[model samples]
Target: MKMKCILCAAGALAMCTATAFANPAKESEKTEFNRHWFMQLQGGASYTLGEGSFGKLVSPAAALSAGYQFSPVWGLRFGLSGWQSKGAWVSPENVYQYKYLQGNVEATLDLANLFGRFNPVRTVNPYLFAGVGVNGAFDNDEANALNDKGYTLGNIWSGSKAFVAGRLGAGVNFRLSDCVLLGVEVNTNMLSDKYNSKKAGNLDWQFNALAGLTFRFGKNHKKPQPAAVVAAPVQTTPPAEKPRTPAVQEAAPVAAEKPAVAEKPAPLREDIFFRIGSAQVRDAEKAKIAALAEYLKANPDANVEVTGYADAVTGSNAFNLKISRQRAESVAAALKAAGIAAGRIRVNGKGDTVQPFPGVEKNRVSICIAK
Candidate 1:
């Protein structure tokens, strides 16, 4: 039965792997997993190995654990799990229960992240774990009753017994949000023969089927980006260079009457940048919006064109387009709040279809041009 269960888990892992590969992942998500701490609480049923029917050996179980994820693929945790475990013999038709607590330090492997692209938003993650622990069994009154009845149970425990245990398990985790997850797991534990006080001649086996919630602490992504640098408005045309003086005196005598040319003032322009994956206008960017509003107010005839853009490197085309539109709308709203009439402001989002700036970070911006 244990071998069959192992095979079933292996088959499920293979199917998950196939599904991961079937989907297209252009780039891996850059979610920082280091230094994140998580806690889990679980409750379920436990089954112990015995000669009696399967239904006779089932009992209650629960567990609590806390751990740290070292990376996307690996983590370590310490957990305490156990409750009632039953031992039974069919020949005498006797069944007895005992309480036990097992504490284990286990290592975890995230199978989905290990086999496929690491996506922070991916909803489901399957994992495998193994560990070693010590089990403390006590409150064996039922076992004592069986022993007193001459049931031939070898060396019944009087008070308590402590023995080594080993565990192996697999589970699936459903991400509920940034810091919470729902999970289900099934694990088998191997313990010393004396744990059940039945002298079963071989090691005892205990199985747990559990469901739980995990709460994690720490940000999944790295630090929020710093404020973008605001570049000074650029001139559309270069300044005229000073003409060189004539080396010979004859050049002064040849001055001709020419039409006077009037130079045009440079158009006002400013850029408001945004942090990665965010559309909210920062306080620093607000100043630029106010300045742009002032320019519009100073020249009633001049209108400002606000165009928003997003980087091509981060999100999907649809996601990029959505955020780009949001970025533009946010800037336009800010301008309106600053007393700039909506009719005078023209706003549009280019998404990643156009790159107005050179760098990826610089592309996440809204350019305002007054003409």
Candidate 2:
């Protein structure tokens, strides 16, 4: 008997777990890999400190970077940066001079909400990237002057020379629209060797902040279409007979009939959407919400069920289920504010279990009629 009771309890527990997993509300969808080409232009200021003919200088710098992120979470970036800095000569005579144009290329990895670890807020993502590449340096006018004076300036390089370099930085990427992104990042580059130019000697670090825009090209994930609207039926009234009917009334009075009233059809349901992995609705969904509010006002007896759904991007099955539920609850709250009766509405979140669409936007809300 004891063994039988234990088995029964285990079975009950399993059933409860299955029930929880079965009805996941939709809001927990994860962001997918972004495979597209992107470009950015950034300009900022940097202070250089290292071994160089010129001691130290602070200068304004600009960079134009273009790259492709094979997935939403990773990519490669190549940028050309140039700066002019004034440095004090440490040796013979104390003279300040400007030197070298620098450029490089590196791979970047995006860490913001990667792997569906967290809910996405705005489309903006903060990322930390590190990669190894090459930095090129060219001799400036200062190097030319030293050469003319017959000073033994090391390597008197005039064009670009490649040196091993790496970069570390943090940046935020904001999606302006479906295919455009605005990004800003600040990074510091460390070169393997010091730069030697006529004006400066050991400049070894390149640091700058960059801001630019990127255009994305690829297939867009499918999104739910707006609910279709159905108009109400119209009623017609019969025209009244003239007073001459009084003479005919002497024979037989005709009965007057009421006008036929048209029945109003049910209002269209509203659709709710969210940022990838987040419960917050995007601004684009405002119009849909307004339409929903109007529908609720017109149909007082209608009951609504808001079911949230998430994409298969992240989280354990249980966690995704919980996220989906929260998303539904959020929509329910919005409806309540729009005069929907609390008792007439139901809310639920279904994690990534059932996807309405195959892509990232699959994280969404479903509104069902209960009346």
Candidate 3:
């Protein structure tokens, strides 16, 4: 039956091996496992419940385990645990001493990873574990010791040897660093009725509470990424200079023609529209602003007015007023960037009353006029 149980457990583990790494992948997540194989050393208190004295059942227990984590969620461990428990039955007459040892094959489950782990603040993982193993008794002082104490106990081995042990436990581990974990675990062990060399209706039990550190080892595998390549810059040659023309004799200067009358300043109005609900100016609209800047640069004395508005259909009065102000500020900022004198530009943030376009979309505009 022990062999059958072991085979069944092995089979179940094989089936779940693939599922260990089934966590959903994320793009921004950069954390990775540095090592896979790990060893743990733990020490804690152990207790036993059987046909022994009930008082002071506590004893010292310790274990050393080695394991490989298949993924963040699942893994396997093998360990040997030593337990020393001193107690007796409730009657206080049948006192028993126990020295127990066990070697186990345990399955580990990381509960945090199994559930959604999106919260950044939660870094600790609580886990569940179960295992089956061989149990043996080292101190066989059952019958002889009870007789020496003048207690006519039922015929039973005070110190027995060689039985099966099964255990289930829960623990919480805090990831101290990428390669280190600190945790505490409590396991309860179950065994055959004759485990303590005494006849009992139910299986005997042992409880272990341990604190440990897991030291990880192995080469870390990194997620694959494509390499980036840069192109070399192209070089160009300068154009050759043309030969100078022969100098010509200077001609007599003629009287300058009467100064031409200054032409009337022409008013240039440009309307730039933005996408609905967006304060960002598109690429196409940038060209228009650039052209206006160039024209103003050519005509130094020219002054400009920037009026911004939003469509009433798209936004509330207060929102439209705010957006309109943003639109004017954006256009004014652009003009200032073009080397235009700040004093020559007048910015006005008006209500959504200027619907110059055929569609409501057209009303979301900033109008610039240079005179």
Find the candidate with the highest lDDT and give its number: 1
Ranking by lDDT: 1, 3, 2
| Candidate rank order under TM-score | 1, 3, 2
User: lDDT by residue for model 3 over 51-134, one digit each (tens)?
Assistant: 443345567999999998887668899999887865465565455566877899999987756664322223366678998989
RMSD of each: 6.4, 18.2, 17.7
**Candidate 2 vs 3: which has more TM-score:** 3
Clashes of each: 0, 27, 6
Please report, in order, the local distance difference test score of every candidate based on alpha carbons.
0.81, 0.59, 0.69
Clashes of 3: 6
2 or 3, greater by lDDT: 3
Please give the lDDT score for candidate 3: 0.69
Question: TM-score for all predictions?
Answer: 0.62, 0.44, 0.50
Evaluate residue 204 in candidate 3 and report its C-alpha lDDT on the 0 to 100 scale.
76
Better of 1 and 3 by lDDT: 1
TM-score of 1: 0.62
Question: Tens digit of lDDT per residue, candidate 1, span 233-310?
Answer: 556655566576568855456556456554544568888999999999998888888888888887878788888888
Candidate 3, poorest ten consecutive residues by summed lDDT: 222-231
Clash pairs of candidate 1?
none
